[model samples]
Target: MFDIIIRSATQRKVRSGLTVSGIALGIFALVVMGAMSENFNQTFENSMSLTSDKIRVFAESGMFGGGLTDDKVPDVKRVPGVKDAYGILLTTFDEDQMGMSGKQIFALPPEKSRIALDPVKLKAGRFLEPGDTYQILVGTSIAGEYDLQIGSKLEIHDKNFTVIGILEYTGSFFDSTAAIPLETAQDIYNLEHSLSTIFAVPEEGIDSDILAKRIELNVKGTSTLSPRELQEQASQSLLIFSVITISSALLAAIIGGLSVMNTMLMSVTERTREFGILRAMGAETKDILLITLGEAALLGIIGGLLGIGIGSAAVYLINLWLAGKGIILFAITQRLLVVALLFATVIGTISGLYPAYRATKMSPMEALRYG
Candidate 1:
């Protein structure tokens, strides 16, 4: 049946090409949009998973690594429910100041933050060590972007720092962050003993919410967040993106289906004489319907393959472009590919139903004479 459909399509090359293009376009759009949504979900989960067992302390008012002080750490640790706490310093260096464009610096004390740094697996070199002033650990994306290796220099605030390690693709915040010693960060930013945030671990039996509340009360001028709160924030951030991607992909699918329906209808009309001849030669109405539907499904499959191939490449290119900045905005997964193909096939099968029915309704003698 596939061979027959392909033969027929080859005979009407222009029509088949146009029909395939429509399905391909729709599948392409669906794949890219779906991959982006997948990226958001994956990154969100990775981030949430990284901090699920801990609580985050921040300044009462500020965003993106607030100016929370390390002084709050002792107070937070003194809270009964808190087991351990450590401060992390963060600062974004720009092209003018650091000779690097919009790079975020993630600094922590290595000895105290071992558990904290555990998630940040190294790709090429070593993690930050104690007394490691002027050494940096960068994300894989950034390392690849600048062709950086061990001993490569990164200039920040007119000071040259060496890259000692490249971090694994964490699929979290650190994927886009560069790490250094806590004290080094303070010096370069001129923020002596200042921290951007404090990460805390609650006692074994202590609830994160209760620990957060206790820390807030014990440490003044501070804000606290449990994993649940971060989950809520992530969900809120992805809501708009999810809606837009779903709506656009669905719209494209509908348009593609319509294109298939129109093209199939025309093909049935043009093939009336051929169908009539087949019927006269002992072909049943079911045979006519089967042939027409099979052709439509074949077009869909070809289009889907074309679309998926192109879409996957597009996703790679997009990720590659942002990888330099230590970011990935799209991810192509095997599940997404299967879904795209199935969606295309469904659209094709449904679109062919009406045209197939029309062909079945044609009388052999009348169709042969009319055409």
Candidate 2:
């Protein structure tokens, strides 16, 4: 009986092909959109995970006084329930002052800290080392845009600095940044002995937020945040991307599902007499329903598989274009592939249920006599 259904479906080659193609296009768009959004969220999580694991306090008043500072670093470390703490200096240098484009670039210290930022990848040169004067690390995105390389010189505030490293693509805001030593940035920016923030890590099982509040009370003119809060703040920057990806994917999936239903309904109408004949042959309503539903499921599976293939290819092409711009973070893992295929299959199967039930209820005598 299943083979007969397949044969009958093949008999309407043109309609079947068109229906399958429509579903494939819809699922393709949905899968790509879903994967793109998920990737961004995952990237956000990865970038913030390490940052958040450590509580950070910043001075909230003076240039750096209003954010985190070294003055409170030791006290925060000594706070009850605190485990470890470190101080960081943040400042920016304007390149245009040195005859380069006047872009404000951020710099960080290369000291071991509670909240350490590890560069994702390096394309050229090396990271910061103690006493390494006039050196800089830049993101690949900036490297291409500025046509820079190892040993290339960048002017920072009327000072010539050599490019030391090109950071690898990490799908976060950090991918487009430049980093340097704390002292180097301070001198270049003319900020004296001032730091941006301090970070702390809690002891095992300690309530980080509670610890933060305790430290804040001890240290005047400062605020503290647990890792979770920092991540939310960081992810907030990418919230728009998440919304667009999810909304677009859902819309595509809905359109595809509706198309599947429309095709199933048309198929059922065309096969009304066939359903009547089956009823005359003693086929139960459930059997009729199963047959129609099964056919729909098979169509969905095919379309979904095709969609996955097409969508994956599209992602690869997009990545290729981005790679030329110094970003190569678009990765399609096995899990994503399987999930997309499964999503397509479920949408197809669910959409066909109503039409299949309507076909099962067709009366043999009535269907036979009707047009």
Cα lDDT listed for each candidate: 0.83, 0.72
lDDT of 1 by residue, 50-111 (tens): 77888889989854545687788888889898888999887775545462444577789866
Worst 10 residues of 1 by lDDT: 93-102
Off by over 4 Å in 1: 1-4, 62-67, 93-103, 123-126, 190-194, 274-288, 317-329, 361-369
- lDDT tens string, model 2, 119-143? 3667767777767768877876667
User: What TM value does model 1 have?
Assistant: 0.83
Q: Which number leads on TM-score?
A: 1
TM-scores of all models?
0.83, 0.77
